[model samples]
Target: MTAVVNEQTSYLSDRQCFAILDRASEDLQNGLALRAFLASIALAALRPEEARVLRVRDVELVDDGTGWLMVHPQAQERREKDSDRAGTVRRVPVCRELAAILQEETTRRDLGPDDAIFVLDNGRPLTAQVYRKVWQQARAAALQAHELDSPLGRHVSALRDARIAAWLRNGDQTAGHILAVAECAGMSAPRLAERFANCLRKPTRDEIPWDRLEAALALPEPSQSTSTARRP
Candidate 1:
């Protein structure tokens, strides 16, 4: 939502995230597109690399809004940073919106299990470079001048931060989901915190005790510093 922000280098505001989604959707309807799916997984809290190499078979899009991606950190041919987890697989639940978009993409292309979900204009697999370029274009088109160059969220990976941050917004319950989200994202819980801690929501106006704060602040005049003349 550009209304709240145009973060060029950090996580997106909800409105900006949705705007990108809306733009991606429009682009997808125009023809074969990757940006929409990109937005989908961004909302789903996936790293760019993870989403980049996803296979159709790895994702199951059901008629309902829920879906999940099975991530393999280790596979000689294709892999993620956590691929060395002794061939372990992690499943990350995705919202229905993302599942629906992916379903459409797979169905439209008649993709099989091993087929890469996204491809480049040249029909090669979607690489980070290709996706980055496309994201720049999409962001510029979707955002206004101020947001175009700020840490507000310029890159696609910022979506992961945004999504994770969104989860952390649930307040105390945030801690409970870190391990699960980390597993899904192929990173450890601490790493997840390091990367997306700032995404956590701050206290709202109502949550602040402004009256007490003001009363406390209003109380007293500052005492003057004691004279430090040498007593020699």
Candidate 2:
């Protein structure tokens, strides 16, 4: 029965899933943009484009609530004419613990409504290729940590897969949450579900491993030199 269940579900073990999330979060905390990008996608189930376009203004806390991190879409048309990208404005409620990080990041930068949230140290917007490379590096680190072999590391969408997994595991089984996420990501809900349903399962609080998250926060702050070095 155990084997049957394992074969039938084919889901990543809880520990493995948490490890991936943990590593990604650590990367983000360490000021690794690519890692942070991948981690956000994994935690929020956002599209790569959406993650890349996220600016300080895009995130908000609803009614001063600590549990949600609203993610608004980017105003791409205004930023670049002839750019066919359109963003959907949506609110995402995150773990209350993430509030400080959100606050610090927003205040740390000089971002306008149209500015790209994530950027290179040179002040250039993070291109898809650059983000993709960071994702590759993160995947390699994750695989090496686990001593596992995976060809999926080469795929940029893998981080999205990880996000879907986290979402589903967190109890977003109904289409409501997924739809909300997709709309915020500027994509159709049906399309997201159709392509990524397998990763969507019921969510549980334990799925997030908040204990591990708290520990990561306890680590020392990065030196100003190192921290400021990544800034544009």
Candidate 3:
């Protein structure tokens, strides 16, 4: 389906994002379909198509506790989307928390690099249709009715939208950032910005520079003599 331009203004808050991720990451009993889907989008800003087709080979985990997911043409036999064009690639970083989760899954299945990262009971790659169904069920479990109805994480793509919007609001939306996100989303910078405007409202607690705020307070308070010097 074609996108509904400006159709949503309520992207996931940090709290909501965590709420969803935490639930999805709970256990393999319920299944990793939603867990992998949520982690792929929430952690890396991967589009639905890109995330669904992700293979173990595309994941690069560093010994230094950082990792990245590769979204590119090599993941497929045929071009899946614009970003899948020959020579086009985006390396989406995976945070420590998400990395640990992925590592656990990889170890559990003893998967080779060529295997699918997110799989099913029979150990098959998840299709987009199944991913969306799992997403809805997971959302119902993780979110309240109002939140579920809201644009926040409404579609799988919204996770990518929310992550990029958070980056922008956190004051990291430089040209380089825009270009990187544009590559991942397969859209121009302006288009990406316009679509995610709603999610770029007030900064979240994570975005605030608490260290800077504390540093300002650490400055010595004015003494009576110092105050007198400034008097008219």
Task: Name the best candidate (by lDDT).
Answer: 3
**lDDT per residue (tens digit) for residues 1-232 in model 1:** 2223332225677777776766654554332456655765666777666677778889865556787788655444144443334356778887877777787778877889998887754566666675666667777878878777666666777788777766665546346666766666666677667666564556689988999999988957545553334334
Please identify model 3 stretches exceeding 4 Å from their true place. 1-8, 25-30, 73-87, 198-232
lDDT of 3 by residue, 1-232 (tens): 1112245465666676666666665545446656756777777777776776788898899998779878764444245333334456767788897788778888877989888777775766667777676666666778787666666576777777677766666656666866776665555566766766653455689988999999988978899998999999
lDDT of each: 0.66, 0.54, 0.69
Better of 2 and 3 by lDDT: 3
Q: Single out the weakest 10-residue window by summed lDDT for candidate 3.
A: 1-10
By summed lDDT, which 10 consecutive residues of candidate 1 come out lowest?
1-10
Give model 3's TM-score versus the native structure.
0.69
Structure candidate 3, residue pairs in collision: none
Query: What residue runs in model 2 are displaced by over 4 Å at the alpha carbon?
Result: 1-30, 62-88, 110-114, 145-148, 172-193, 196-232
Ranking by TM-score: 3, 1, 2
Write one digit per residue (lDDT tens) for candidate 2, span 1-232: 0100122233333344345545554544334444455556655656666677776656666556454444555554335433223443456655444554555455556557666656764677778876655555555665554333434334655555554545544654666877655554445666656555665664588777798889988978899999889999
Error of 3 at 169 (Å): 1.3
Residue-pair clashes per prediction, in order, are 15, 11, 0
Candidate 1: which stretches are off by over 4 Å? 1-9, 24-31, 74-87, 199-232
Error of 3 at 13 (Å): 1.5
